[model samples]
Target: MNNKLKLSNEHTLARVLEIKHYTKALFSFKTTRPNNFKFKPGEFVMIGLIIKGEFIFRAYSICSSTWDNVLEFYSIKVPNGPFTSFLQKITTDSSIIIKTKSTGTLVLNALTLGKRLFLLCTGTGIAPFISIISEPGTYIKYNEVILVLTCRYSQELQYFNYKVKQMLKQPYIKLYARNKLRLYLSTTKGSYPYSGRITWLIKSGMLIADLKAYNFNRMDKFMICGSQQMILDVVNLLRSIGYLEGAINNPQDFVYERAFVS
Candidate 1:
């Protein structure tokens, strides 16, 4: 019997360090990061499990800052998802496969200069934003950073809420985050102070009104991640107002990624 791990040249093995479950369906895990592994905030990489001598992989947005020694990922368990069903059962004893390369348009470098940076996401889509916000470079790039997270239930927001609090309390981050970071939570199905889809909140001006922020304009940049429908609706709303989609080579007013959609 062979116990040695086997992986392709482009992949590496990482040991699971910790796991936290936010809800029956939502969970996050941390894994040991290879010394040579590097990525920008908001980028995503392919990760997977080994089963029956076969590797099953999925794209997962990184949830930890680039400077962190360990990599973190947020996930949602699907009833019989090929990857997630097995992934959810993993413990610290497990080792996962991680592809070396990482890429995504949600990165800060994808957007042009802007006064305010708005990060809008739904469900596990909040993963990359967590990495972005935790990066000290993010605070230096914009005068204000707004993170909007919408989920089906209020409980789904607990993990992010705790992360935000931790950032606000960290000495190095608190100084800037306390003044620049703003979080708004919304629930589509359950009771909450804010309710309804984020697209509606934005179009109806309820989100801006609640933030007491200046009206959205060419000078504001947006990063969005969520389901196909959520992304389309939000993109349409922004495009109608003259916002252009951005790319790594071409900087524009907004960018988006669907890595966490599953």
Candidate 2:
């Protein structure tokens, strides 16, 4: 008559460490990582909770640096979502199930050498980019790293702001990436320093003004993660300018992965 929940054959049970709510729809949580669980920054793994005696899982980008002892995830609370609705209710000390297989194309290994690296995202797509920038490899590979994040409201940008500030203040990061990392933000539905779709910004040359470059050349590498439409639009835009898609086996000018499955 044992009632203890048994760990699934393919998943590991992780203890939640902390949780922070950014808005009604967005939140982030940290969970203890398995000592043997290893993954590159920018990769993703399936995570979920048991509901109605069944486990429901969803792919989530690992937001924490690879070096972090705890795993972190940024999530959107979709109303009636199969997993999120339940996930949003998670609290510290709760159990989270994580699949060990972490895979994605957003890692640094998928991009060729370039002088500048652009990390473009919208909403929770910013998750993978957070991991990338925190990894020292990002700073060592490029002289400049540009991070652009667009959200529906200014409040949604708070998590990014905090991470960016922390990255800049760290002695190690400051020494290597000081004055090299740049953050651009836009709020689509509210007033912010920037307001507009990132694609429009790129097409209108406004983003380029900040880039201080007229064209996207081979010297620039782009890692994009966001909505399907956003990924498509940016991919087309980059292709129009001769940027080629890259992969682990054949690194090229750019790489991308969907932030969430639509």
Candidate 3:
């Protein structure tokens, strides 16, 4: 199946906006979007850069909230590789090409509504969480939001921690009595404020306590993103606990996507 389609200029553009450095190799950007363009959060887009008359493209998830006019993405610099090598040097307001028609299954619409929302991710996988966490509607739609992020070390968790701290200062958002958003983090290779992989935490029921969650049930929704292994791990674990998969056509207790192939 030729699922790939060449987009028209209407859906593609070279706009420059903001650039940010998260770690030594990971960075993010915000680009201007066409006035008429709109998309759900967590959808991946074909982003590319023009170099030497060639367009080098890669799949990147949109990390910005849908209400925002501009699109956002979190990226990793591929050493001496196609787009990232040059992308890392891009300053704020630098131009880069983007394709139209973003698509992916990670959007919140794909999952079944539940009493609690579990977002499990690792590394850049936290990209989509940025969008989900920022939306006040996300909190309104679910009773509670619990995010579990894993990285090689605590430093990688800094980007997410900073954003949540900012959200905490929002008076209106914090006003939602039971609509609290919690962050659970683990660092596999290095010591962190929190200890292990999400799978381990869930299996041992440690994450449930850490989030102060009651219990896993069909009344809960789970969004899993990370390495294939992590997704499978969480999926099977959830299934054992009675959670199921979901889609727009047939919403289930859970939905999934790769954060960025780990």
Candidate 4:
């Protein structure tokens, strides 16, 4: 990936069609999709700002499912981030630049078939998991799709609940039933049910205790997304437990990526 971000010639001043605030720092936006544009849900897109004759670009996960015509993204308002500081202020129909290309390793193609799949995340990292859960293949291919989400409080969980309810009602996802999709929220700071950092939850045997119905064997695949340190910590723990990383070209026991920071 390029370290120094620059606007691509293909960038456009697209209009924002809608926005939904999920939390003080978290928000979701929907924009008019460029003509003939196509992308998988888990992919990340480069969004840029063309203001005051200078361009700034940042990567963001495409939160909406592929079947949707418009592009959607869930983002965090980084207090003083060059991009997010302004990106969060976008109102309906405001013009913003978006790159044509979408890329990332979080897509379903990165992992192999497993009896159970764990889509692990924290904070805004839950963006991609929303896409994975809504995809038709998720229910068709995996016996159990458990989304283990970690956040500071339960408010973040509400957005997920809304999305899950919407997904379960869809004709394609109706087959999911209750067993196919399970949610495990680990709230770290707040006094929520299952309170602690996700890393501790897993290492302390608390995670397993929370999901008493099943035991994690090598047969389970894990897809993790979070901060760089969080990814490294989770992957290291998985390795200690015999879980291997997978890829689109070379499948394994797990797959992960650095979450998009503002």
Worst 10 residues of 3 by lDDT: 1-10
Clashing pairs in 2: none
Over the stretch 1-262, how does candidate 4's per-residue lDDT look in tens digits?
A: 2345555567766689988898888888889888767777577888887554577788887778778778878888989987888899999858678888778888777777788888889888888888778788877778888889988888877777777788778876676645688888888776887888778988888888988856789779898887777788888999999987778899888887644432
* Candidate 1 deviant stretches above 4 angstroms: 1-5, 258-262
**Each prediction's Cα lDDT score?**
0.89, 0.86, 0.77, 0.80
lDDT winner = 1
Q: Tell me how candidate 2 scores on lDDT.
A: 0.86
Better of 2 and 3 by TM-score: 2
Number of colliding residue pairs in each model: 0, 0, 1, 0
* Candidate 2 C-alpha lDDT tens digits along 1-262: 1256566577888999999998899999999998689898889999978887876788899998888789999999999988888898998858888997788878888888989898989999999998888878888899889998998899999888887787778777678777778888888997887888989988888887866765666799998998888888888999998999989999898888854535
Off by over 4 Å in 2: 1-8, 211-214, 258-262
Candidate 3 ranges beyond 4 A from true positions: 1-7, 169-179, 258-262
lDDT of 1 by residue, 95-114 (tens): 88899998877889889998
- What ordering of candidates by TM-score runs from best to worst? 1, 2, 4, 3
Q: How many Å off is the CA of 176 in candidate 3?
A: 4.6
TM-score of each: 0.95, 0.94, 0.87, 0.91
* Greater-lDDT candidate between 1 and 4: 1
Task: Give the per-residue lDDT digits (tens) of candidate 3, residues 1-262.
Answer: 1235444574566576888797997887888886677677677778876666666788787787777777878877878987789888887657666766777788788887777888899888887878888787788888788888998877777777876776567666567523477777889887677888888998888888876668677678888877778888888888887777788788888888754445
